[model samples]
Target: MEGRAFTHTRRALWETRTTFETAPYGSIAAAYFAMWLGLRGIKLSAVILHDLATALGAKAVARATQYFLQSLRPEVGSQPVHGWDSLIFLIIYSVIVFLPLWWLADLRWARGAVYRYRATTRTTKALHFCAEAYSRPPGKRTSQLRDLESGLRAAENAILRAHRYAGTFPRRSPRSAAVRAHAALVAGALRAESLKIDADPNATLPRLGAMLAVIGERCAEGRIGAMLSEEFLAEATPVSLTRTAIRESVHVIVVVTAAMVAAVGGSSALRALGVNDDLRPWLIAGCSVVAAIVVGGWHRVGRLLELMPGK
Candidate 1:
């Protein structure tokens, strides 16, 4: 019976550890909210310019390539001849259709990243304060420690259950990376507190002070602390990791939207140009190539940025 009890206790601790390791959903929500506010702060002219450039570039390249291919093809039969003017018209129509959708999607993603970052920062601060308080001299310190542990356990379980739900739903994409980072910081702080508890579960004042000092120092210098500081300082300026994340998300949306517009517009242009049926495969292939280039380039750039220090 004792062995079974020990096993159950160990399992509970492990669950608590896992929960503490994950970043809280509240942090993620707040970070995204901040990003949304940042997006609103951007200049309207700049946003319009960005959209125009993307649309123009995509249309120009796609139309030019389509025309060049059409010139090489033999006139097999008298079908519909979609001239350059028709192709241009289709491109313009497609751009107008897709740009708004892309912009909104980008905005959503940017907001999410910001929310996660801010939330993590706040949670870390709270956890650090609690850890320090729990480490004070005995008497009140002991009571505080018990209360903190109890609170942490409850929070951890709730977070774990939320994480499980997040994992189960594709639409519920929780900011796992940020969550894990915060969780690590909390666990480290808790571990330091546990050391004090084991040294003198009776909660001696001197031991509590020493433990608090040591844990406080660790919390201040550890990964979580560093991340929090980085975010806080970054938010002070426009050119921070958070900004970069927003920009990258915007770029991706623009690129993907351009590709889709080009593909659809190119198809419509082909239909209008009276191009032969044999040319359909070539047109489809060309559209695929454009999409691949945009998507592949976006992926490479995002990966490179992620690999960069502080990103």
Candidate 2:
């Protein structure tokens, strides 16, 4: 058992080392480092541009050597290509290209991810409906009173469920906050309507109705995802945002320019000193990781300028 365990561990280590040696580890490490720095508000644009330029160059080189790039020439395939061959082709094409692009661009895939982690679609719809209901919503006053009543009832049920599962949420959980807010709003609206009815038995209620409509509009159009609402977590860029961007842009330019020069000059110098091909890629990768860490950590010091507040 001990011998088998030792052999398995050694084999795993050897495989890992071999993969690193053959793969584009230098470019990968540099790319990740660039992303970390960018996210931390280091001159993000410059770092990104550098990575983009590198990718373009790499792609150009790759094209010369590789064949069968996801699909054939469009002009060559004028005839309708159908059956099992087309199905297999589409599966391979999607796996190689479409899936990565979808994830990177955060298309419909993000919505699924949002639902999986936070509140369900049913809960979100209930919150929105309740918010709109409380405001009475324009063109939907007494005409949709039944819908308003049903929405509020659904929201109340959702809030009760949320409270019951309070342990499932995070400290600053948006879904929980939204649920609580809607529950309070429902109670408040009911109380306000009751008081208005008691004070004036035959009140026309034009002002009260208008106010609710406006509030409902805000709630309906204010959110990006289930939890990120304008009222809850503001997405508007701050006044100081321009200044912060300029500073970071300058940082990126300086860092990226220096990195390019060093990479070119140092590589040639190291080659002259007889650095073997086997060791050179690892050295480059190490440098890329170090560069990313330093810039990322530098901005993480002192006060983190809230580039996008509450993001």
Candidate 3:
């Protein structure tokens, strides 16, 4: 009896399932997130490297200028060079660290949507094939059950391909709803057809044929494609464009700010500690690690909040 109950439950789930198949979103996100965090580390390292290189370069330039000045005027040799000369260099290094990393993050973020579109294309293709396959004569369809089921499975696979990624995005959308509805329609009809075949291996299911006819009519209407197209195009609207621009600008600002703070602040903190010049480079490296931790932790905290139950 227990076995029978389990079988019935399984059958019910198979027949009624409407949600997109689950993908490895959590695993993929975790992996990609590690890489994202590594980019922060790289940014920190860039700042450290920039400071060291500029220190050495500035020293050489200062020595050359000092010698040239002393040769021209013996008393001018003792004049001090402004320490803030490297400020502009630090800003330049910040831009160097910002652009490529920012581009990579944007690419990773956009990848989720790219996969979604691919999944939609595959599912739509499968749906169209199923509709065509169902249009066959009843006798021919008996020999085509395997093919029809294969098509349905393909559609399910396609939707699942990006399911996990889609979950990270906002829930409500016309395109997603339409796709879910179409999948449910197809899944229900196919499950019913299979049950009929199981009950009578050789008989044609008039009920299933009528259901398939309706499904074909629905597919013919092309409502799913229309809805998806509408939603996709809506992303290009002025408001959406402005929102995207603002979000991108925020990312750039955050990254550049972190880089500058880590570089300049690290040097100042070392100076305040009265560390000897020989230890300053080593201390700066240590400070970079600390800065990476603080900045990366802050970013990850925001991400965790975003992934929380609501907003």
Candidate 4:
């Protein structure tokens, strides 16, 4: 039962990857474009509101900003805009409106959609391959299975290392370090498994199980275990882990892009409305802080996703 389950899971993962790789560029492009459009809409709306508040009535602008700041409690420091006075109303209003839209479009909706799509596609392919491999006579396929298991283990180890090192190094460090580590590990594991299969066409299920146990034990001792529970490790196949990691990478990209777009739009909208000239410095500072938080949070989420079962 365990062998059958593992094979099924791997085949599913391979199928999922194949689907993603084959997807029309236009479809993916459209999804990303929609995210941008949503962000732009929010920015435009905020700008219009800011202009209306400023030109139509200063008191109205002040009241609106106050309400927004009070409600949102943005980390605006002790500046003129942060005060009860209406001077920075337009800026505050823009931020209040745009921040939520950005969050909704990028972090919540778009990210979820992307993650689910990738996960489904990758898992499908992996499981298909696993099933095919397992269907072969045990004596004929033992070596191949062993090699595959080893490759998978190596890849898993690399991914764990990348996760651990994330945010630990300086800002200027190459982004590919983590990615490379993961890739190397995956390649090594796959290579080992392939070799084993070539050497021995007929391998037993017990040997395969032992190989899995070895990898699982090593992974559990590493930082990778912190993110993935023993239950997940025991049940998950190599294909699933790889697929999950890829899906998570997509989410990170979407979320980070959305946050950046929001920051720029929010800043621009605030400036256009001329809501808080006196509190300009503080407002900028506050926005910077918020942007940092968003980016940091997005990174953490990506890491967590990578650690999850069933990529």
- Relative to the true structure, how large is the alpha-carbon lDDT of every model? 0.43, 0.39, 0.45, 0.45
Off by over 4 Å in 4: 1-190, 204-209, 221-311
TM-score of each: 0.22, 0.28, 0.24, 0.25
Residue 167 in model 3: shift from native, Å?
25
Number of the predicted model whose TM-score against the real structure is largest: 2
Superposed on all Cα atoms, the candidates' RMSDs to the truth, in angstroms, are 19.5, 24.8, 20.3, 17.6
Question: Residue-wise lDDT of candidate 2 within 1-311, one digit each (tens)?
Answer: 11223343233234334544323445445545655554355334434544664577854223222222212344535544333234333444444443433333223222222222122223334334444444664445553444444443343333223332224455577765555554344334433443452254234243333323332232222221222223422322222223545875677666555555556666777688888664664565456445544664433321232222212
Off by over 4 Å in 2: 1-64, 67-105, 108-238, 295-311
Candidate 4: residue 191 lDDT (0-100): 36
What is the alpha-carbon RMSD of candidate 1 to the true structure?
Answer: 19.5
Flag regions of model 1 displaced more than 4 Å: 1-239, 273-311
Worst 10 residues of 3 by lDDT: 230-239
The sequence of per-residue lDDT tens digits that candidate 4 reaches over residues 86-202 is: 435555545544554444433442233222233222222333334446677756655555544434433344444433322234445675454444434443443344455545534
Q: Point out the worst 10-residue segment of candidate 1 by lDDT.
A: 231-240
- Select the stronger candidate by TM-score from 2 and 3: 2
Give stretches of model 3 more than 4 Å off.
1-241, 274-279, 285-289, 292-311
Query: Which run of 10 residues does model 2 get worst, by summed lDDT?
Result: 109-118
